[model samples]
Target: MADTTNRLAGIAYLTVDGTNYMLAGDFAYSVSKVARETLMGQDRVHGYSEKPKQGSMSGSIRDAGGLSVASFNAMTNVTVTVELANGKTIIGRNMWTVGDLEVKTTEATFEVKWEGFSVEEA
Candidate 1:
């Protein structure tokens, strides 16, 4: 039997400008911040400052998700929301696509990735 350890089951959706698209398999996201740096001064460590945080989301489009390269390229103020079956919600706001999307017909997969201004978990 296969062991199901730490498996995540969820649904992810994207709202570009104002349109919403339900995502398919391989959905994932992450949040990160700049590495803390130690100030170098005359004597020793001084203090730490605030660092910018970044969020990213990636997923495959469901069949007939109605995603268009023209519209995606012109997107502004994008947002992505993921709802896990574990009763957790992750929201990414003010996002933009990182690069051109790649569509593969063999497996009916359309991959998309976005970098966002912030990520909120609730």
Candidate 2:
């Protein structure tokens, strides 16, 4: 199952007011537009159109700049711990700031092990 397609894709057309959250089995990414069918006139003339929406893909990792977010906006000096189904855990610290990742998620099992340092405005 580890090598299987155990991933999820989702979009978060985020704004200053709301926060969108998605739980995926694997990796997540964002997209530009969403297509929809529109009708016009007396006839149900359906047409495809685009909208400002988000999308997720399997085995896709996005960067923060791609998401149009600043590094300072995200958490800094953080540590991550990944736990596989085999009951083994892998820990990484100072890997990158939150601003480095466009999308980040922590599963119920693989928790944020610890934090060594944090960002501060000087």
Candidate 3:
């Protein structure tokens, strides 16, 4: 088995059916403050713009079950919410076909980056 301690902040790709997908994105415990803050909404407003904008909202990754499992089934659709420390939640859906499940892990955390999904507005 892979030690999984050196995979921090690395991204893994999974092949689902005939499509290539991101199986997971490992978020390191040592993630940059900017990234953590952006993911957690501690920092918002990249700078005010008079024009309208389209972009991802700030929030943290959340799950009702939390981070317990390391692998997910192929041809599966998973919805995981990243909850900002501020209590705001962003939902992401992963739709994939059945294939060899892949993951990138660290001693602290692991992730399956799901492709073919969209982020729902909070």
Q: Which candidate's lDDT is highest?
A: 1
Sorting all predicted structures by lDDT, with the top scorer first, yields 1, 3, 2
lDDT of 3: 0.35
| Residues forming the 10-long window of minimal summed lDDT in candidate 3 | 27-36
lDDT by residue (28-101, candidate 3, tens digit) is 11112122222334576564324332222121122223433333444356554443333334454554323333
For candidate 2, the 10 contiguous residues with the lowest summed lDDT are 108-117
Off by over 4 Å in 2: 1-23, 27-73, 98-122
Which candidate do you rate higher for TM-score, 2 or 3?
A: 3
lDDT value, residue 86 of candidate 1 = 55
- Highest TM-score model number: 1
Instruction: Give candidate 1 misplaced runs (Cα > 4 Å).
Output: 1-19, 36-53, 63-66
lDDT score, candidate 2, position 32? 28
lDDT of 2 by residue, 12-67 (tens): 22111122222234422223245465756577666656654322222222333333
- TM-score of every model? 0.66, 0.25, 0.32
lDDT of 1 by residue, 1-122 (tens): 84545645654455554566756677777766554667778987788666776778778875464546556556557766776655567788887877776667776567778787777777
Report the CA-based lDDT of candidate 1 relative to the real structure: 0.68
lDDT for 28 (candidate 2): 24
Evaluation by lDDT, superior candidate among 1 and 2: 1
Q: What pairs collide in candidate 1?
A: none
